[model samples]
Target: MTAPRVDYDRIRDVGPDRAASEWLLRCGARVRYCGQQKWTQDYNNLPTGPLDRYKIQAIDATDSCIMSLGLAHMEGLEHVEKITLSKCHYIEDSCLKRLSQLEKLQKSLLEMEIIACGNVTDTGILALQHFRNLRYLFLSDLPGIKDKENLAHLLKVALPSLELKLNLK
Candidate 1:
């Protein structure tokens, strides 16, 4: 099934968790069981595998009305190949920690943009070392990540072989 077009207004009334769930469902996510509040709950709620037979290749939640913890709900979207979180000021180290758990993205994720997120620090940037297949990464205007030189060095040591195009400023 072709993914449905994202309609922010259609999900504006709900909480972030609900918005994420609505996104998955509307994107033609195929799962065994899915209910209104399933993505909000625990254990049984989160899908262990891909949301659909075909992977959700990309998601751009740039400046979306959602907080850091909201990322937890997206963990179930196991096959995401690219994500853009640019200008989402509320996203911090914790959100990156949550993203690091997406082991499937380690080899599939090709690009990621987290620019202008004020709270992302070295800890968060380090967490991204897991994305071994990442060919492009954008990180700019992050206050928590103060030492650019160190960060560049770290990324080099961490992702030596990958020809990553970095946009860090």
Candidate 2:
């Protein structure tokens, strides 16, 4: 009996690497996710500095894809000047904490905007101080965070020039 044939071309057709890499590359300034993809197949924490090389400008994460933030954070994406997070309530607090590594960037003048994430509080925002180059910030629609003084302290400590635009309204 003959064994079933294997098509190397068909195997190549899946193009998992090409797909993930191209998607991330084409997405400039920001990457938005409204639905989930089977991303874990290619997601790697391995140091491929190319991800950090881009000036990602911004990220608008909403709906089901918010969970992927952990992958983005691990890629050391804070080199981007701005980030907008909305409706990513599924993201864990650890995701924000991951930004602490942004300080390691050679020239880290960046800021982020967070909205509609009910789980992230002022504490999470304050934790961003580790990104010393952060100069502008925005926070809105976070129900768990109770105070700004701590957030103020973080700015005062890490980036005295930091200007935060908070919209609780």
Candidate 3:
């Protein structure tokens, strides 16, 4: 049987699972985003220093449920400057819709990566067009994006100065 889903405090104590990371971030704990390989470990309690000293400026929720809980919880973090939601195969237009609500993302976010989000479509790209100041965007391995020409045109117009790394196959 599965254990009960812990609330915010238990999540902080455990540290670094998707749920725990999301929980800490929501509480303004400023947890750093380690890459996917070490994501499930309890790294928040390291002996290096006190956790409260670090302010979270970035989040890499790669292959995690950013379309749902991540987007919902991140709306309040005005300090978040970068986010990577790569390899989230099920993410779709709805994820972008949620991102639009994050005024923080529109203002402070400089980089975003949505690689391999195969379900994301042109509508999602349109939604991203709103981040006018976004400097860098990376999209790759998206099989569902068929209209490459339109997508490219839209990106050019929407993010005129954006540096893009696209591999939409």
Candidate 4:
């Protein structure tokens, strides 16, 4: 199957947070809106109200097919605090780079977990330096990462307050 396409017109119509939620849900990812307790996973059952009423707070893209291009949906999200990416086949180092460049996410994102994503390497981990407010990071099972200790040390130096956990071999 082809990768899911982003609808820019939907972003303009429903606002970035809602549009991103739709894209993520359509790709089998779950999203938690700010002030909402349950994660929204069904594309057809999306919440209804004012288009701009809900803000995306967290994304759990475990085993989803989200790719580098799909990360564009997150560009305008300003309230996202956490993201978990596990076993996403299409996610790559470039995806992380694209995520880091999002100005709104830089200040709001606090925690991130990258697990079992084969294409991710030290290059992608390093891109997280741009998230100035990020406090916690978890990485595991990424065989592409070659220099674990050095990369960990570099991240420590760059983000002094960050709590990092690694389970690489």
Q: Using TM-score as the measure, which candidate wins?
A: 4
lDDT of 2 by residue, 1-169 (tens): 9733333343354332233333433332234222322222223421244332323333445443444342433243333455567777665566677655544431443767777887877667766777677777877777777776666676677778788877763
Candidate scoring better on TM-score of 3 and 4: 4
TM-score of 4: 0.96
RMSD of each: 11.0, 10.7, 6.0, 1.4
lDDT of model 3, residue 106: 84
Model 3 poorest ten-residue lDDT run: 33-42
Candidate 3 accuracy as TM-score:
0.69
Model 1 poorest ten-residue lDDT run: 30-39
lDDT of 4 by residue, 1-169 (tens): 9956778888988899988998899789999999999999999889999988899999999989888888888889999999999999988999999999999999999999999999998999999999999999999999999999999999999999999999999
Off by over 4 Å in 4: 1-5
Candidates' lDDT values, in order? 0.61, 0.53, 0.63, 0.94
**Clash count for each candidate, listed in order shown:** 0, 1, 0, 0
For candidate 4, the clash count comes to: 0
Which candidate, 3 or 4, would have the higher lDDT against the true structure? 4
Model 2 stretches astray by more than 4 angstroms: 1-55, 72-79, 102-109
Which candidate ranks first by lDDT, i.e. highest?
4
Angstrom error at residue 118, model 2: 0.4
Score residue 120 of candidate 2 by CA lDDT: 79
- In model 3, which regions exceed 4 Å deviation? 1-21, 24-54
Clashing pairs in 2: 29-58
